[model samples]
Target: MASGTVLRSHAGGYLVYEPELDTVFQCAARGRLKKERVSIFTGDRVELDELDSEQNTAVITTMLERENLLSRPPLANVDQVIIVQAVHQPEWNPLLTDRYIVHFQLELSPALPVLCFNKCDLAEESELEALRSIYEPLGYFVIFVSAVTGRGIDDLARTLANKVSVFAGQSGVGKSTLLNCIEKDLQLKTGVMDHEFGVGRHTTTSSELYRLSFEHFPEIRASQTASWVGDTPGFNLLELKHPQPTEVVWQFPEILRLAQDCKFLNCLHLVENDCNVLNNIDEISLGRYNSYAAIVSDAQMEYSRRQVTSQKVEATVKKVGGRGGKEIHVPRLSTKYRAVSRRRERQGQYEEIDTDDDSIDDSLDATEDDTFQDGIVGQENLD
Candidate 1:
């Protein structure tokens, strides 16, 4: 049995590698391993038994513990999540960046989050200044690189040396191009530069590891260390599931210190009567508050919208027969309505009465009385 890490999982099976032997086996895990609910995923170290030397197939028997689990791409042992944002193209989305930063900050202990600004060739001097002011002061290492110009790739190359880093960005941010620049032979398809928006199309569809090197361009050598990078497809803008409000407030160091002065114990930093956050909201970084508002509002709106939509969906389902053409009996409107219905049912008075029947009957009687009075008045006029 050889121990190895699973690189990727495909339709047939997973790619398990025994790094010690430098042998990767393509096989599935035993039934017992799955029965015990032991999940084996990409980047998971596991013990494998080689079944056939001819086909190079093997069986994963045991899974080792992981240092960290990046849930989005399902990566198990990772060093850092390299967040790539473009200066132009889709533009710099501060809210999305904060969401990613806070997500990694809450999930990982070592705080391995690196910021990489791709397409820096188009970055303005003001953009660079803004990046330095926002990220550098927060003790984040920011690297500016352009895949086309081969600028700052050396520094980025050194950063990825002897480490496992994942490159994540929105579509058209040039993740595949960056990877291709790192490994020349990898020659991963590069998407066309969108003339309208000045962004590349999403060419890479799967998350696969590419080994970085300076063999292709010896002149670009900086450090001699084996490194790997994972390129993932882009996704829509969404808020991360942060820790509790109290914990989440402390994620931004500036906000954490300012939160001590908040009047209420559970203040969410909104315009509460004596909210310290409100008083200092403008004083501190406006970007930070903007991010907070967006996340909080997004979560609240999502929950409320889901609730209303769910009620409508349930009502529609109840009206139409559910699966198998089964009859669905909706409960009475309320406790009062249920009590009345129960009383009527006990007396065998259920005849599907119209809800407005009594009101309509009373209206008809009143109209008839008025008409008869009018008729008597007309007779007096004639006499």
Candidate 2:
């Protein structure tokens, strides 16, 4: 079989598409991909060989290089990310937008992010105008489209032509409605607008790409053809681990502009002395700054936790001297592992101690219940 992108993944396996033939193949891996800890996500281009047409099976032999990837939904080779937000329903969550923007900027090619304000007709004039004014000036193209009335639907349709776009936003933001409007033929299931909450119930349960067709173009008046659009299920809030401050700042155009004047080269941007970020912080969106601050704080806490954890790992590795032949050095923490030894003294069920510098930290402070310290090792990679 030829190379194709993985559109959907399931317990059975993946559905890969060959654009050349416009055919979909059901493929599975010979070995457990997750066992190796490399999650083969959707939007990944892979090489496949047909196992048996009768069995509807194929083997995924190779995965193609990806332009960008994300851990949460685990997708790859995405062309652009559509950030769907509403003018009124569920109100505006700039913090959520920050989360999306932060994740997108970390991508390899600075993937294009388009903000679509759905339910435009429902929005008050001031609300609609305010959103356009804020995001449009910041380099992001803001489109005001009403999925119900078809207001600006032509422009929205033009934007989505011949592209792979992911519709992402909080629950009830009209992602499905917008898709239904764009590809009217699909008549994709959509929930009614909630009068009480002013939001729609999430009708989509899983992420799936749909082929959109237009019979007659309003401008060209030519024959209709099919275009691809991917719709993702709505999420309440994005769960993001602490990311690097440099990466976080880079995501926000406004913050990055202000960060240039920061006092220190490595300013954390939180209560730093003579910090330009802090001084003009109010000028920027409060929600955006808070999101950045939260991630930075998480990173700082994770760092502190790692220091404590490394000390323990170093001591354990020294005691075991395992055959891994790895040198255990716990920086940011004292070489002495006495603190961990003392802490574990009361626990009788402690198994073999791990002292590898890169070993994951298991230590957690009871005083700070939700606080997690960042260490050299990640949540999954730790031995």
Q: For all candidates, what are the clash counts?
A: 0, 7
Evaluated against the true structure, the overall lDDT of model 1 is 0.64
Off by over 4 Å in 2: 31-38, 51-57, 192-201, 215-227, 236-238, 245-247, 281-287, 298-383
Off by over 4 Å in 1: 51-53, 110-112, 193-201, 214-226, 301-383
Each candidate structure's TM-score, on Cα atoms with residue i matched to residue i, is 0.72, 0.68
Clashing pairs in 2: 302-373, 302-374, 303-374, 305-373, 306-375, 313-355, 317-355
lDDT of 1 by residue, 211-290 (tens): 56667656545555556778766543442444434445656767756766787876777668868878777666778777
Write the residue-wise lDDT of candidate 2 on 1-383 in tens digits. Answer: 57877777644567777767667777775443332333566777788765555665667766766656654434565667788887767677776676676555444234558888887878788988777777787788778888778887787777777666688776678888888776677677877666785555666655666655654345522433435667775543324433444445655668877887776876777878788888897788776678778766655665567678863211111223347785432212212212446655545223213211322212211111011111111322110
Worst 10 residues of 2 by lDDT: 367-376
